[model samples]
Target: MTLSFFDQFMSPVFMGIPLILLALSLPWILLPNPTLRWLSNRFLALQNSAIGNATQQLFSPINPNGHNWAILLIPLLLFLITLNMLGILPYTFTPTTQLSINLAIATPLWLATVILGMRKQPTIALSHILPMGTPNLLIPILIIIETISLFVRPVALAVRMTANLTAGHLLMQLIATAGFVLMSNMPVIALNICIVLFLLSLLEMAVAMIQAYVFVLLLTLYLQENV
Candidate 1:
């Protein structure tokens, strides 16, 4: 059997069970569970420190009402970061690379923000449909455009994530394949390619982490507008 370049994105199965479930759940189990000891492990301390700093930077601008979303945002940020980093390992599938999964996650959260705004401040929410001091003729056009843009937020989020990961994964695969094929015939070039591949892998790791933070950060921004 031959392997397709895109096959990496597909969910694998073993003994009739999809491994996507494992991919989704494995990250949570790997996280450090709190213990009853007075002094925590250094790793746990580092983790807590990182979380605290991230939360401060992310939620500092929002009012107290929006601060309550830390529970939702922090876990999600960690989950995405783990999933993305895991996918970097050999033979692992990234759930975020799938648009359906991303849309499933992004749409409801985005809709919730909109709903919160409408529920908490209907005037402010409705007012978003049109800016103040608009010309009579432009009001309808502005409203239509804004309304369409409002609906497209989730799609934009899903596509941004899907595209970034998909493109990076594909590119990395292409480079690795070229290196493998050229190893015997063009060893010098292949050696250089290997060095490049190592560098690119490091960059991809950073991209993976940054994209996850950006995803949660955008959600927090949406929540801020609402709360």
Candidate 2:
């Protein structure tokens, strides 16, 4: 039975039960736990140091009041990165490729930031709806445009990630399928295709990490505007 290229994005199941929960929880389990020792193992220490740097950079632009969310957003970044990288392995499903999952993750966090901004500085938050010195006739038009953009942030976040990952996976599958089909009749060409596939795999790995960073970074910028 031939499967469609999009089949890879399908959520997996066993015995008619969804395995998405297991997939979502696996990243946490794969991460190393913090230990009480004065010095951690080299790998764990490196991990901690890297995460610390990311946390500091992410919070630097935001008002200190917003730093409280570092705890939530940092772990979220790690979770997404882990999920994305893990999905690169054979037979693994990428949850982030699903628009529903991405939207669910993004929308609430985005709304929370908006609410926080409005709560802390109502006047300032409302001011973002329209720019200064606008023509009398243009006021309503600008307000309508700004309102639509404001509400579209989360949807943009969801679609950006989903589209990037889905396209990468689709291209990789197409390349691999072509390479395998050509292997018997055109060995040299198939070998060249394999080399190209290998390079594309590396590019996908980088894309996976970068997309995760961009996802969180955009959220941080949104929080910055609010705080």
Candidate 3:
């Protein structure tokens, strides 16, 4: 079916995200795993047992919400896909690639780690972070430096993703838009540019997946550090 330029733009926002999310998550959804299976059986066992029986599995054999992470994926995956597609849409920028949005997501994640660390070990947290190996005089200065470095994690994460996505997107736009602009006067040059744009689009698909993986990996590392 024929689609207007506006429709093409909206297609990524509306259709592309849902489809891509579903495709990427099918492995987790469809694949049978021990976690879900054990929970399912526990669920059935509870229904069959009496009121006195230990059926409520909040912090025991089963989690409060069995396969809840899987459920959460439905939204997280959707959001990520939508963000990726946002840049692909015409006359629009990817919010995910914006420093503000990236910092919004990253800052909280890092802060959560710090808070948890503090809660787990009130005095030890500071000593553990700063350590006893350093000189006494340097303690205050080191802490100040370390504190700034810790907070800079989100800023780094935000800039890294935003810059990468923006650079790649600008490259794509330059090729595609420039090709279209040249079509009137320089037919041969326009044709060559179109080929370059086509290649760039294909490369972009790979980049989209790489960026998603990198983001998730960084998230995991941050969680591990604090938790």
Worst 10 residues of 2 by lDDT: 122-131
* TM-score of candidate 2 against the unseen true structure: 0.98
Order the numbered candidates by lDDT, best leading: 2, 1, 3
Where's the lowest-lDDT run of ten residues in candidate 1?
218-227
Cα-based lDDT at residue 76, candidate 3: 45
Model 2 agreement with the true structure over 1-227: per-residue lDDT tens digits: 99888989999999999888899999999999999999889989989998999998899888999999999999999999999988889999999999999999999999999999899998899899987899999999999999999999999999999999999999999999999999999999999999999999999999999999999999999999899
Q: Write the per-residue lDDT of candidate 1 for residues 40-102, one digit (tens) a residue.
A: 999999899999999999999887898988998899999999999999999789999999989
* Cα-based TM-score, every candidate: 0.97, 0.98, 0.60
True-vs-predicted CA distance for residue 185, candidate 1, Å? 1.3
Which of candidates 1 and 3 reaches a greater TM-score?
A: 1
Superposed model 2: Cα runs more than 4 Å off: none
Best by lDDT: 2
Model 2 alpha-carbon miss at residue 141, Å: 0.3
Task: Compare candidates 2 and 3 on TM-score and give the better one.
Answer: 2
Off by over 4 Å in 1: none
Give the distance in Å from residue 137's predicted Cα in candidate 3 to where it truly belongs: 4.6
Measured with C-alpha atoms, the lDDT of residue 8 in candidate 1 is 95
